[model samples]
Target: MNAERLVRRMIDVGALRFGDFLLSSGKRSRVYVDVKLASTFPDILEMIADGIAEKLSGVEFDRVACVELGGVAIAVATSLKLKKPLVIFRKEEKSYGVGGDRIGEIRKGERVVVVEDVITTGRSALSAARRVEKSGGVVGAIIAVVDREESGREFMSLLKLSDLIKAYDSFDTTKS
Candidate 1:
């Protein structure tokens, strides 16, 4: 789980893009990190899982939780690697068939770590954490693959926006 290599891989796969984009959190930014793209490539996904697993070392957690969509693959891979139970929070509460806002159950007082593919304002990850808390699970930590740095919230991240920019610059330089 080398950071540089991971950034380089992201660059190669076009996961990191620079453009005017609107984030799910409703923030506008010139940088858009599409880690979901990594999910389509098993090797890239594995690398992310490896990096996340490495970061989780020494952190005590009973369940790994994540919001639906972007974080699913990363969370599933991490859960598999760490042998931890997975709890997935839905984007919205289900209206039918055992209606609920989440999949899997969290035992009372269980320590949970919320995972996110990218964090801008940290809304999605924090929302998932709040859900965990409401379900009697303690949010031990919040982790992300990339942090846009637009949000002042503190969270563990495998890469930062600056790191990606640096990687992109280096990559572009080599290409020229």
Candidate 2:
């Protein structure tokens, strides 16, 4: 399915909600996109993975990286769809472990793409980008399920990591 249809389903499935809401950035928002359903539903998740994989076509990326939690499944799916390796960025460095809070299977000078389930202020993705860059991964792009028309996209651009982000209206739909 296309992004439009995905958006319609997200709204129908209560994954995307419109209201006055407080964001993690301590900012108020008129919209909130919760995409757990899309990541969990087989058809929908495959659609999302396929869409993202298509976007990666012709792009030479050695690995796919995703932020903690939400991005985990999506990144894995995308990697599977593209037959590429997957790595996950944790919220915090592990107190003790082999790859706790690691940049995910990335080596110095490896190519990477950051994935997220949603974006609002873009802080999380930016933070993850820094870790990836600092660890020596060349970030190619940022992918999100929703843009939220907020500081998220700008934050990525400001960081100069990647202004290249892709999102669909799937998280913003009418007739809910």
Candidate 3:
């Protein structure tokens, strides 16, 4: 799908939110990409998966990894689309039966691409990449559905903050 169409859908679904918000990075922002909301809609989620998959088409990776709460849906969809294995990381390690921080196995030296819903400071994605490294997986890339463009981190994303902001501005102008 085209970027404009995806942005429109995101707006229609109330996924791209505006106004003051506190990000996971502990920073304040007026714009927030609520990809978790988008995931609730299968069509939107599919578009997201398509975008991520396209980004990884040329990149080589053995598995896709992401943390729970937000990135799970996108990662799952992308993993399915690419027919690749998925590795999920928990924000906190579990203490119960078969306890561990991750859900799937990562073979030694397997290349991994860390997936995230949004990239702000990139701490979340980077942390997942580090975990992949610790688990004996090589970090191939860090990909997100949207890049907030705040961190200046080297990563791949389907859409950037500027794209959303431009679309939002045009939307507001049309509404006026």
Local accuracy of candidate 1 as per-residue lDDT tens digits, 94-163? 9999999989999999999999999988989889988999999999889999988878877899999988
Question: Better model by lDDT, 2 or 3?
Answer: 3
The TM-score between candidate 3 and the true structure equals 0.96
lDDT scores for all predictions?
0.90, 0.70, 0.90
lDDT of 3 at 30: 87
Model 3 misplaced regions, further than 4 Å: none
lDDT of 3 by residue, 9-123 (tens): 8988888887899999999998888989988898888899888888888999999999997899999999999999999999999999999998999999999999999999999
Model 1, global lDDT: 0.90
Q: What would the per-residue lDDT of candidate 2 be over residues 4-97, giving only the tens digit for each residue? A: 5665555566765657988777888776667666578777778778777776676778888888788888888888988888888777788876
- Comparing candidate 1 with candidate 2, which one achieves the higher lDDT? 1
RMSD of 2: 5.5
